[model samples]
Target chain A: MKRIIEVKNLYFGYEKNLVLEDVNLDIFEKDFLLIIGPNGGGKTTLLKLILGILKPWKGEINFYDDNISKKIGYVPQFSSFNKNFPISVFNMVLMGTIDSKNFIKKYKKEEIEKTKEILDKLDLYYIKDENINSLSGGLLQRVLIARSLVADPKVLLLDEPTASIDITSQLNLRDFLLELNKKITIVVVTHDPTSFAQIYDHIACVNRRLFYHGRGELDAQLLEKVYGCPVELLGHGIPHTLLKEHI
Target chain B: MLEVLSYKFMQNALMAAFLASIVCGIIGPFIVTRRLVFISGGISHISFGGLGIAYWLGINPLYGATAFSLAAATWIGFSKQDKMSESDLIIGILWAFGMAIGIIFIHLTPGYAPNLMTFLFGNILTVPRFDIFIISILVLVITLSVLIFYKGFVSVALDEEYSKARKLPVRSLNIGLLILIALSIVTLIQVVGIILVIALLTIPVAVAKEFSIHFKKIILISILFGISICLLGLFISYYIEFPSGASIVIIGSILLGVVKGVKKILKMKLNLDETIN
Candidate 1:
């Protein structure tokens, strides 16, 4: 597979406290990469660096054949949006269509038509006219996903896709993501490994540093190194026990 | 109310009210949704420095206010690290400093203070035709800008982090918003002085928010509400001893209180119905 991104000796931190240190990773074309890490283990930070939101203090993140901004679509964890905010579901998702230069121009007919198509594909066309504040957690997640996909991005990045979701919806969502994995690249930062157990192309573990546990059976030592503690691999398949912490 | 409208000053005040209400209506939802009420307050108070410098330099007071507020707001938005609280601290100092400069200049002015209370507490009855004409043009400019950049404003207001993720020039948009806030303050200070300028900008939108789920509705309701409050406050102030600026804000507060009370009663009634069912 062709490599799409190259991260070499990356170092990043916030004012005086270092977070990501000497990290390196490669994301290949059409790879559904799962980046799993403990809480506050720099998974989000790594993603931000890759998205070019936060500048790396040292080292470079190189994206092949295109700019990161034009190539990637992003879905944030929880947007602290006011429920009383006056925006329709259609308009909220339409915000993803704007870029730096063409903000003055209205969204074209074809672009808006494409947005509707994506909404329909995600089974969210029924609530397109509804106020965004009225959506439930699952529906909102789907809307955000549709928004990220509307631009036809080469790579889609989601931060904590399974957060606050019910088990049934999580299973449904994984199935949907598996379907999407065939068409485009996806990099998900999540702790819930079981949800993506059968769908993922490769599993990468991250702490302050990264350990790429290449695309095969995930061994125990890699999990131990990533979490900085001992862990157990109990089973596999749907709802697989990727790592059960030894208590 | 008819007799009040007969006078030239009252007519001018009414026109000022019309202009200020429209500008307030358009700008209010953005500031409220973005939760920049405090920043608008900071910018308004800083406009006081402009008033002071205008008096000291023998220039138009509103021009001084416009210059100072625009500078202060742009400076605050542009000169920033990541910490929001620190910027708020700087805004606080600038707010106080502007007021201090205004007071010192007003004290230094040679003549008999030129009725400083009008600028402080807003004597809308004393509004001149020139100020009325200028604010009208400003309202027109504001309306055009708002309509043209409606989507950009919506994106920035609703979800700033997500807008940032989309690479939407979040920094420029933020600074642009500050500039708009500054302009709105300059227009509003004549109708409601430094002490209550933010109230004029925000209170109508606050009530409107509960009723409207769309920005067009919010903006329309806020404008109507602002105009009604302005007219009612003018009439009430004519009869009562309360200052017009303070009275406008007081009326807005009472209306907000009433809205909250009604909402509470409706919620309780809904619960009662659910319980009965």
Candidate 2:
């Protein structure tokens, strides 16, 4: 597979305090990359650096493709937005088509058509006219996904896509993402890796440090090395019993 | 009411109110959605420092307010950091500091500031033709800006991080929005005075949000609400001989209360009907 992005010796921090140090990773075409870590382990910061939202203090992030900004789609946490703000699903998704070049212009016909197509593909067309504030956490998650996909990105980065949704919605979103991964590279930054188990091609455990694994399953030894503890299980709320016994 | 229009002053006041409503309504939804009410309040108050300085200089106070407001808006917007507390602290300092500057300058000015009350608690009935012209220009600028940058404004207001990730001009949009907001605050000063300007910018949008679930709709409804409230307050102030700014705010607050109360009762009724069925 062709390499899509490369992070080399990355160092980042907020003010004087450091968060991510000497981080390096390679994202390839159509790779399902799952980044997991404990809370405040610089997982989201890494995603932001890749997306160019935050600048790296040291080192470099190289994108192989030109126009990487337009090529990469981002889905932030569902709770990131103001819940009371007035916005329709269609309008919200339509905003995805807007880039820096079209800052002062109105939406074009093609962009509007593309937004509709994305909503339909996500099974959200029927509720396109509905207010976003009226949506359930799960449905809102899907709408956010639809918004990101409307831009026709080559690589999609999701920050905690399944953070607060229900089990059924989580499973449905996993399947949808799996289907999408067939078409484009998918990178998900999640603290709970078990939520998307058996789906990721590679797992990168991060805790101020990053330990990358090629296989889908991470053994207890590797988990301890990353998390700095014996890992018997990894999931949100419920125990997954997925890890092997630590020797 | 028709007799009031016969007078030239009354006509200018009405025109001022109409134009003010248009601009305020146009920009109010953004202020509401972005939760910039505090920042706007800070900007409005800071303009008073300009007003005071302008008085000391024996120049047009509006010019001073306009200059001070724009500067404060830009400074506050650019200086804002990631932490909410830090930004809030900045706003708080600027808010009182501006007012203090205004007070000190006015005190230093040799004579009594005859039009001081007009700047503090607006007298809409006394609005001059010059102020009306300025307001009309502002209305035009604000309407055109909103129309042109509607998508960018909405995107940045909703999610700055996501907009930045999309390579959208987040900084430019934010500064642009702040500039428009500062202009709106300056225009509103003649109608509501610096002390009550935030109310005129917010109350209509607050009420309009109750009726619409779309940004464009909220803006349209806010304009309508603002115009109605301003006119009604004008009429009431004319008859009852009350402070126009205070009257306007009172009417707006009452309308907001009524809308919220009525919606609550209707919701309760629906719940009862559902339970009975």
Q: TM-score: which candidate is best?
A: 2
Error of 2 at B37 (Å): 0.8
Clashing pairs in 2: none
Per-prediction DockQ scores? 0.51, 0.70
* Candidate 1 regions with alpha-carbon error over 4 angstroms: A66-68, A80-84, A219-231, A234-247, B1-6, B239-241
TM-score of structure candidate 2 = 0.93
Highest DockQ: give the candidate number.
Answer: 2
Candidate 2 residue lDDT tens string, B180-265: 99999888999989999999999999898889788888888888888898998888888998999889989999999999999999
lDDT per residue for candidate 2 within A28-99, as digits (tens), equals 999999998889999999999999999999999999888765699999997677776788999999988878
| TM-score, one value per model | 0.90, 0.93
Error of 1 at B98 (Å): 1.9
Error of 1 at B125 (Å): 1.3
